[model samples]
Target chain A: MLKNYFKIAIAVLKRRKFFTFISLFGISFTLTILMVLTAFIDKVAGDNYPDKKRDRLLYVNRIEQKGKDNMNSGTLSYYFLSHYTAMMKTPVKVAISSGFSGTNTYVNNKKIAVSYKYTNAEYWDVMDYDFTEGKPFNKQQVDNADRVVIISEDMKKQYFGDAGPVVGKYFEADNVSYRVIGVVKNVPVTSYMFFSDIYMPYTTSKADYKSKSYGGGYMGVLMAANKDDVPKMQAEYENLMKRVPVESKDFQHLYSHANTFFSSYVDTGNEGTSGVFIVVTAISIFVFIFMLLPTLNLVNINITRIMERSSEIGVRKAFGASSKTLVYQFIVENLILTLLGGIIGTILSVIVLAVINNADLIANLQLSINFTVLFIALLVCLVFGFLSGVYPAWRMSKLNVVTALKAQ
Target chain B: MIRLQNIEKVYRTDTIETLALNSVSLDVAKGEFLSIMGPSGCGKSTLLNIMGLLDVPSKGSIKIADKATENLNDKQLAQFRNKTLGFIFQSYHLINDLQVLDNVELPLLYRDTTAKERKMLATEALEKVGLANRVKHFPTQLSGGQRQRVAIARAIVGRPDIILADEPTGNLDSAMGNEIMDILINLNRNEGTTIVMVTHDENMAHKTHRLVRLFDGSQVQ
Candidate 1:
């Protein structure tokens, strides 16, 4: 019986190709745009690669010092983090690393611009960067201020022009020569916390980076045993800052909090307007608005289709079809249309995602719709089919048999 | 048997009211062949629709086979319509989307028949209608006369207690119209199936056992 209804639905849709095309275009286009947009957001704020332990980690990247007439705001000083955050009970390991700085130098008479980061040995354990060759320098090397650097796969290719045993070879950057101790995969550019062209020890630099008067230029990446301990670790770090005596008598108050990636983005310091909530609400509204017009258009098209088939409906009703059967039949027809649209949308999204990834449009913006995105698309399609299918089916079912049969 | 008592149907709009049927009492005995003749706007089709439960009379009591139907719920009405009544229309009203066999199988869908049983029953009905060779042909592929024959086949395929046809020959010429009349006569006489048809032609009206004439929403003869 349902098969017969489907046959009739297909024939009817074929009879009115223009309307079907319009509906399919609306449904597929809306779904594709939504999936692409979701992919982008996931790439930006979501965890990937070495940051896969994001849920189990917290970052202390900023500090604020307030006095009667002065206020200072910057990244927490290495001294502050080492002295206070190192003693944290909740964190299994507290790794400190410098933010990115430009290394503009000449190698083999070729000018290369590389982003460099300074790190201690614990930085390797806290983050999981995959090594292609050799290993990260040990704590002893960092303490001895040894001249060693870890370079990315692309860097090795650029310098040696081949995937090579260039590890033990020396390369000069910023007028300083260092042995290439390790080679790692070229990290995607969007991974701001870990991506870098070269990594060295903070002590290897000529300037003293650790013993600073004011807080800035360093981040304390704390690895907790479990994700649920993040809030407690943050509170304990905040409490530890209270006991640290001010080196300068002029400063009276200190403020800082360890934060996850999401909290850090939404941390307005006011605590009332959260960035995560706002972004989620905005995206929700965006998706709703995107789907609204298409859903309405599909509903109208379904109404028109049902209207054309009213005589058939009347005939069926006259032959003992109940309203339930009619409604089920129409809904099935609509579901078929919506699922077809979903398939088309998925195909289009794959092509679009592949193009974006291959074109290198956004540096390190490798995007794909995983299972979560597919599930979202399917849910959206189901909701879309229901929203667009029900009212028309209901109205068609409620129609009087006499009036329906009289319709052309 | 089918019975209607003092049936009154009124068409109401915001500003006016038109009486389509007024104080009309009707009875159709078992195995009876009845013809109702009326001019345009005389409520023949409206009365037929009411009798088939497709439309409700404003003030009337309907009883079919000793079951009072006016108070029956929608589901009950549908069940009764499916199990006890069948309909044939002026345009044949065969669903064009379905093939001849599928269209004939439509009534069975409302019953508890399985797919295999439905196919078997539908096949037998098509054979009875003399369209055994065209089981898979869509309605458009058939002639006007054949479409009406298919409509008759669908009506009787369910073994309905009664068949109500509204202008069964309204769209056909005399020859095709006579062929339809003959089918109805044969079904009534041989199978003992009650048939009530509405026609404008005097020749067709005379073929039935009893005749009714309506004018201005009332029975004149």
Candidate 2:
């Protein structure tokens, strides 16, 4: 029976070319933009590359030091991290890395700016970076301030012109000399916490790490043995935050929490709610509002289109079709139309993403419609179909049989 | 078999209440071929619609095939219609987007019949209407008489006990009209299917088992 309705729906679409084109244009155009947006968000926040164990990881990126008259909030300081994170018992590993900083280098007499970060030996174990040549600096090397660096494949190509075996060669940056110890794949800039052109040991920097300040230019990555230990780890960290005493006379209170990477990214200072729930609700509302106008337009168009088949509806009703059956048929027809539009939208998204990637609009960012994006697009299509179809179908089903027949 | 008692249908608005069907009582015997005749605006089609359960009477009780219909919900009424009644209309009312075979198989779609069985029954119906070769053709591709035949095929494909037709041949010429009347008469005599038809033609009425006349929203004869 559904097969028969599908046949009729295809025939109807073929019969009305103009309406089909208009509906397809609206649906495909709207869904194309949404698909591209989903792809980008998935690439940025999804479990990709070295952050695949995101479910079992937590981040402590912000520290708050408040006084009677002044309040300061910034990334965690190395001293604050080593003091507090060492007291937490839930985490199997805690890796601390300095915030990325920009430095200039001269390659082929042309000045190029490079972003770099200083990390400890355990940072390599925390993040599973795929190294292409050589190995990371050991704990002994970091303790000795070995002046060894690991550059991304992209930076290696830029400084060496695709030269072979430069792992032991000396590289100059910020007017300082360092021996390159390893080369790894380029991490997309979308991974805000992990993306850098080069990485070095924190001991090699001249900054003071023994300061008692509660805030500085550093972040900590916490890894739990399993996902179930994350909450316990968060609780332990929270309790430890209350125990840390303020050394400065100006500040009397200290505050921080161990949160997920996404939570830290969308940190709005709102307490008592996880950032995941807040961000998901915010995005859902945003998508709903964005789709409202197009859905209404499609509903209006569908009403007009289905109204033209009043006589056919009357015939079906007179032949023993219940109102439920008629509504189901109409909704099915609309779904077919929307799914076809989704196919076109998916193709358009692929082409658009390809253009963006090839155009080099954003460096190190390659957006593709992966499985998650495709599933989201499918869900969007179904929702669009239901939102645009239900009311019109209901209206048609309520039509008086006699009145509908007279419409012929 | 069908029965109606004090059937009343009123078309109301804020300004006026027009009586489309008055308090007219009717009874149709089993295996009876009944034709209803009246001038335009005489409530002939309204009476037929009420009997077909497509429209509710303003004040009346109806029993078709010995089952009381007033208390039946929408779903039960639809099931009763699907299992016990068939309908044909003046304009043929064929869906233009579907082929003749699909249109013929529509009533069976509401039932639990399989696709193969529906196709077989629809093919048999088309053969009965002498349009077996045109099953793949659309309604627009057929002539007016041919379209009426397709509508008849759709009506009888369900093999319902009663067939309600409102001016089934009203739009056809005399030759085509006689041909359609012959089909109805044959269905009545051979299959014993009770038929209640509303027609405007006297020549077609004379061939039925009985004729009913209406005037001014009431039965006059």
Candidate 3:
């Protein structure tokens, strides 16, 4: 019986080639755009920071007030780190780090601009950075290190040719010679911070600044304890701050992780581009709704076709086609049309996503469909098919045979 | 084998009430060939529709093959119709999108018959109508006479006990009309299939074994 229904559906669609084409085209086109947009968003969000130990890590930022100029920065001061480490009762390992600056290097007179950062020894233990060659700077090196540095793959390629070994090689930056102890893989663009070509010891930076305490300087900390203990640790750090030598007592603290930091920043409207994203999302939803109009038109066309075939329906009803059978046949026909449309739409969406991602007109953007995106598209097609078929199927099954046959 | 008792059908609008079938009652014996003849607006078609279980009677009961139709639900009535009765229409009413063979196979699609069986039955019915050569031709490609033959094939493919034809030859010329009558006569005589046809032509009415005429909403002589 099911096979018969499918055969009849195929015959009906083949008979009205133009109508079937239009309906399928409408549905597929809409689905493709929706899928691409959702995939792009998911890619940008970075899959919710998939590290299993994410909950144990804490990101620290500061809300500073200096002479009526208030700035909420994700980076904090190094002075607060020293104070928090000494005063906090919890045995949490704290790592303070800061973004790398673009430094011009003259290796054998071949000048190259490289991004580098200065951080304590604890920085290596807190974040996961893969090493391709050599080893990380140890506690002893960080304690006595004024000439040690880690070089990334790109930096190694630029300073030491492709075949040459970068480890144990000496490089000069700002007239300061430093030995590369380790070579790290180039950071992926998907990471929050893109600039980290080289990393230097915190002792080297501390000597340059000529201060045992860094005040009002760019810094960030990560807690190496369980996330559930964060609030308590944060409170203990706050109390520890009062006894430390600091210029301002009005510094505000915020606790977050790699996942929540970016999401919360977007949600709180802290990022300037949040409004743009919201507008884009709203427009995409509107486009999705507009796409549904074409599906509804197809439904209306189906209803008209069903009416024209009323006598056939009458005959079928007279021949023992129950209302359920009629309704099932109609629904199956529409679902087949929708599924076909969904496939076409998915293909089109992939092309669109590729085009958008490769256009290079949009800055720092990549769009592609993922598993989640495909699932959502399929779900949309199902909902659209069911909603569109309801009235038509009902009307088709409710047909009166006697009236129809009489007209014939 | 069919019986109608006090069948009434009323069509009501906002300001007027029209009676299409007024308390008409009749009986048809097994293997009977009956023709209903009436002028326009004479309720003959309405009576046929009511008898076919396509329309509910305003007041009355219908029995087919000795089973009461009043208690039968919509699904049961459809089952009864598909299993026990066949239909032929004046317009042929072949789905234009489908080929002649597919149109003929439609009635059997509701049954649990396999595809191969359905194809064989539909093919035999088409052959009986002398349309075997045009099985693959769509309705649009067929002549008016050919379309009606296909319709008849579709009606009989299910092997129903009774065939109800409403103006089966109305759209055909006299020659084509005669060809259709010949098929009906053959089916009745050879297969013992009861036939209830509605027509206005007296010549067509005379060919049937019994004739029931109607005027306005009531039956005459």
Candidate 4:
């Protein structure tokens, strides 16, 4: 029965070459758009932080007002740490880090400038950076730190030779002697922290700069103990905030203080730009519908073919051809066309994705036809085939043989 | 054998009801070669259709091979047709997309016959109709007479007990029509299969063993 269905379906398609081509093209076009967009979205949402235990890591931001205006700010300072360190009832470990915006020029007979981040001893443990040379800043170094910095591989190569061992070596920058404590790998382009080139101990920067509000800098906290304790820790921190003495009720009224943490720091604005995705989805639907239209055209064509064969139907009825048998044959023919179309469409989609990926317009995009997308494409084709074929098959099966044979 | 008692068929329209077969009764013995002849609107094809199980009568009891067909569902009626009847049509109805061999093999496809067996049987039928050399040729590639022969091969491929031909030679020239008639005659004489045909030409009607005539949806003689 299956062979018969396929045989008939192949015959029908061969007979109507134009229609078959149109149907296959439309379906493939739709599937390609859908698959490519889905691959891109998957890349954007979960690309960089695959190994990070993001659920246990929290980034703290202070939402506070300055003067008469309302402001939502992310930068925190050492003032927050001094207040929260004693007040917190939980064992949640916090790390304070500050990134300097200005570029520093290293004299290699020529000026090589790079941006740097100054962080405390906890920064290395929190970020989990694997150093290539030397060691991380020690707690004592952060508490009473002097001229020491960890430079990236790119910075070392620019200021020193490519094979030069920069660690334990001094380089003059910003009119100060800075010793390279370690050389680290270059940060990946996809990462959010792409600008920082050097790391300096936080205490050295604080003492030199005389900034008392270090707690209000960008603070990232890691709860390595367990995730289930987060709600309790957050509640305890909020409760501890109420106990801090306020200078005046009016001062308290002017500042609406709330603390919130992000588990992952993606530029939410960049991440939320799904306009391309929407356009892709809409085009996919349109192509699917366009493909279905051609199938409907095939149905109309089948009706005419069936009418042309009405006498044969009558003769078959006379010779004991069951309506069920007729229905089965028609369905088999439809399934065969659709299955062939599905194969062609899948091939076309792969080619289309490959071409688009090679265009280099979409950043870091990789489109591969995975099992999930293939299954979905085949399923869609089958459903479309079944739906398109049902009505015509039923109509052909119900044909009244005597009247059909007798008609002029 | 076939029996029909008080059969009536009325076709209803929005504003009119036309009777195609009315209070008709007939019997046909096994291995009989009978032809039904009538003018236009005379229900000759309608009677043939009822005998073929292609259409049901408005009021009648039909018995074919001692089985009552009045209560048979569409599926059972189709089974009955496949197992007990064969058909030849004026237009050939050879399924133009298929080769002559595949078209001939269609009837057996509905049966549980395996591919190898169906191919053998269809080849034998085509051979009988002198079309063995043309098995791979499509219907469109054949002449009108050759196409009819392919249709005949398809009908007999299942070895049905009855053969129903409606205007079987209407689309052919006289020479081709006579050739088809000769084939039908030889099959009837040699195989002892029951044959019922409907025709408008008097000369063709006279060639059959018995001729039944109808007018105004009723038998006149």
Candidate 5:
């Protein structure tokens, strides 16, 4: 029986080619844009590559260390991380690293700019940087403030023109010379925390390097032994936070949180709700509104189709079909249409993502559809089918049999 | 086996209330071939729609096969229409999208009949209507008389107890009309299928077992 309905639906669609084309165009275009957007968001917010241990990692990107009268709110200083964060017991490793800062200098006598970060030895131990040449600088080199650095493969090629093992070479950065100790894989720019063109030890750059202030241009990345240790470590850190000696006279209050990637991004400490929640809610509402016009247009097309098939519906109803039967048939027809359009949209979105990746629209941008994205696309198709199919089916079902039969 | 008592149908607008049927009572006997005759706007189609359960009367008591129909819900009414009654319209109302065989098989679709069984029954009905060779032909490919035959095949395919035809031959020539009349008469005389048909042709009405006349929403004879 359902096969019969499908057959009739196909025939009807074939009979009305222009209308079917318009409907398919609307559905496919709407879904394509949505899918591409979802893929982009997924790549940025989701865990990808060397940060795979993100689940067990807590980040302290911001800190507010308050004294009696003056509150210092900023990224944690190297002194604060060394004194306070290194003492965290639950973390398997507490890594201190400066945020990537863009630096320009003469490399091979050509003016070049690179994003670089300074870190201690544990930054390498906690991070999984795949080395292509030599190896990471050890504790001795970092402790002794040796002029050594780890450069990305792209940076290595840029400086040495693909020279083999450029580990023993010197590169000029911000007028300071550092010998390349290792070459690592290029990190995608999407990984904001880990993406850097070059890395050096913190001691190499002297800027009040031993200051004990609790605020600066550094962040502490904590790797716990287990995911469950996150909250426990945070609690212990908070408890120890209260006992910290405050010498400042103006700012008195100090507060900070150890947050996961999402929690850190959505820090409720800054807003009434998590920024991630707010962002997700806002995007969902925007997408829904974005889908409204197309969905309504499809619904209007469905209504027209129903009107055109009134005589057929009349004949079916006269033969003892209930309103439920008519509604079911029409909705199934709508589902078939949307499913077809969804397949087309998904294909188009994949092609679009490939184009974006190939064009390097964003540096090292790697966007691909995974199982979750596929599931979302399927969900969109179902919702679209139901939204566009229901009202028209119901309206057609309520039509007067006599009037419908009389309709041409 | 049908009974109607004090059936009245009122069609209303914002400022107008037109009576389409005025307290009409009717009874159709088993194996009876009944024909109804009336001029246009005499409520013939309204009366037939009520009998077919396609529309409800403003005031009426209807009984079909000893079951009261006044309180029958939409589901029950549809079931009754599917299992007990079949309809043939003046325009034939054969779905243009379907083949003749599919058209005949429609009434059986709502039933619990399997696909293979439905095909077999539809084949038999189409053969009876002399459309055996044209089972797969669409309605647009058929002549007016052939479309009417397909409609009749659909009507009788369910083996319904009652067949209500509204001007079954109104669109056909005299010869095609007579041929349809012969099929209805033969079904009534041989199979005891109760048939109530509305027609304007005096010749067709006079050939039925009984003739009913209506004028201005009222029974005149």
Candidate 6:
């Protein structure tokens, strides 16, 4: 029976070429845009290299120091990170890294710009960076303020002309000469926490690293022992935050919490508003509003399309079909069209992503329709199909048999 | 095989009420071939539709094959129609999207029949209608008489106990009309299947076992 329905659906589509073209165009165009958008979002926020342990990791990037009238908002200081987060018993490991800063250097007559970060040895253990040559600096190097650095693949190609081994090479950035001890794969700019052209030991930095002040440019990373220990770690961090004494007279209250990467990215430093909730609700609303117009258009087109077959509907009713059966048939027909559009959309997304990747539209960003994106695209197709198909099918099913038969 | 009592069908807008069928009662016994003849504005087609369970009368009860059809729900009515009744319309009402064999197999799709059984039954029905060689042809590819034959093949594909035809031969030339009439006559005589047909031609009416005439929604004879 379904085979017969498919055959009839194909014939109907073939008969009404213009209607089929219009419907397919709308469905495929909308799906292509949706899929490409999802792919970009997934690439930006989804778990990738270095942040692979995101599920079992928490990030503490921002601290709010509030007095009665003065409010200070910035990243946590090295003192606060080393003193409090290092003492937390719930986490398996705690790593600290100063926020990235841009630096300029000249190589052979051309000027080069690079973003660099100073991280301790434990930062390497917390992140899962794939090293192409040599290894990360040890704790002793960080403690001794060793002038050693790890550069990304793209940086190595730019500074060293893609020739010789980058390990044991020397380069200067921000007027500080450093010996390269490792070369790692390039990380996309979207992975902000782990994305930098040059990585150096925190001790080599000229800034104040031992200050007891509560505010500075530093981020602490906490790794849980297992996935199930994430919430326990967060609770432990919260308890620790409550016990922190005011280090400076400038602030009467200190607010800081450990959060997942996404939550930290969207954090507004407000206790009442959950970043996850806000982001989720905002995305849901965006998708809903984005799909509404096309769905309405498809519904209108489907009503006219089904009406053209009113006589067929009447004949089926007169023969033996129940209203439920006719409705099911029409929905199936609509699903076929939408799924075909989904296939076309998927192909179009692949092409678009390739063009963006090849064109270097975004620095170090490579987007692809991975499994998650494909699954979401398929779900969108089904939801779009069902939402667009149900009403018209219902209206067609409610058609009076005699009146439908009389319709032209 | 069929019964209707005081059937009344009214078409009403906000201000006017026009009756399509009024105070009409009918009975068709088992294996009886009956024809209903009337002018264009009469209720011949409306009565046929009522008996076929395609439309409900405003104030009436219907019984088909001894089952109280008026009380049956939509699903039950459809199943009952699937098992016991067949219909052939004047315009052929053949789905242009389906081939001849697939069109004939439509009624069986609602039943619990297997695909193989449906194909065999549809092929057999088409063979009986003398269109066995045109199974792959679409309705538009067939002539008017041939399309009617395919419609007849569809009507009998389920081997229904009663077949209701509304102007089955109205769109065909006399020769093609006679060919369709012969098929119906053969079906009635050989299988003892009851038939209720609506027509405007006296010659076609005389071909049936009995004739009932209607004028302006009322029975004149």
What digit string (tens of lDDT, one per residue) describes model 6 on residues B17-66?
99989899889999999999989979889899889889888998998888
User: How do the residues A1-408 of candidate 4 rate in per-residue lDDT, one tens digit apiece?
Assistant: 577567666876776677667665655665666566556544544443322444555555343433334333345565555456546656356665664545668565676777667776766775666578987788888777778998777777777767657788986667777888998876533343323567787766634434454235554453545667666666665565556444333234212122222223332222233334565567568756765676676677667655666765665555566777777777677777778777877777788778877885553355566667679768977887777778887897777776655552
When just chain B is superposed on the true chain B, each candidate scores a TM-score of 0.98, 0.99, 0.98, 0.98, 0.99, 0.98
TM-score for the first chain in candidate 5 comes to 0.91
In the order shown, the candidates' DockQ scores are 0.68, 0.64, 0.64, 0.61, 0.64, 0.70
Candidate 2's C-alpha runs over 4 A off are A17-39, A48-58, A79-94, A206-215, A222-250, A268-278, A290-305, A334-361, A366-395, B1-5, B27-34, B60-68, B173-195, B202-211
Candidate 1: CAPRI quality band: medium
Question: Compared to the true structure, candidate 1 yields what TM-score?
Answer: 0.91
- What is each predicted model's overall lDDT from 0 to 1? 0.85, 0.88, 0.75, 0.71, 0.86, 0.89
Winner of 2 and 4 under TM-score: 2
Candidate that would win on DockQ? 6
Worst 10 residues of 3 chain A by lDDT: A252-261
Q: Write the per-residue lDDT of candidate 4 for residues B1-221, one digit (tens) a residue.
A: 89999999999999999999989999989999999888988998888888877777899989999899988887777777788888887777666667889889888876888999999999999988999999989899999999999999988999987898989989998899999999999899999889999998787888989999999899988
C-alpha TM-scores of all predictions? 0.91, 0.85, 0.82, 0.76, 0.89, 0.88
Two-way DockQ contest, 1 vs 5, winner? 1
**Tens-digit lDDT track for model 5 on A173-257?**
8778889989998888777778889999998966676887777788888888988888888887777778776646665666777
Q: Best to worst by DockQ, what's the order?
A: 6, 1, 2, 3, 5, 4
Tens-digit lDDT track of model 3 for B45-97: 88888888777889999999998988887677777888888988788777776
User: What CAPRI-style quality would you assign to candidate 2?
Assistant: medium
Interface RMSD to the true structure, each candidate: 1.0, 0.8, 2.2, 2.2, 0.8, 0.6
lDDT of 4 at A129: 66
lDDT of 4 at B143: 96
- Give the best candidate by TM-score: 1
lDDT per residue (tens digit) for residues A214-312 in model 2: 777898989999999999999899988888876577788887888987887676544446677888898888778767766888899899989999998
Q: Which candidate order results from sorting by lDDT in descending order?
A: 6, 2, 5, 1, 3, 4
Clashes of each: 0, 0, 6, 15, 11, 0
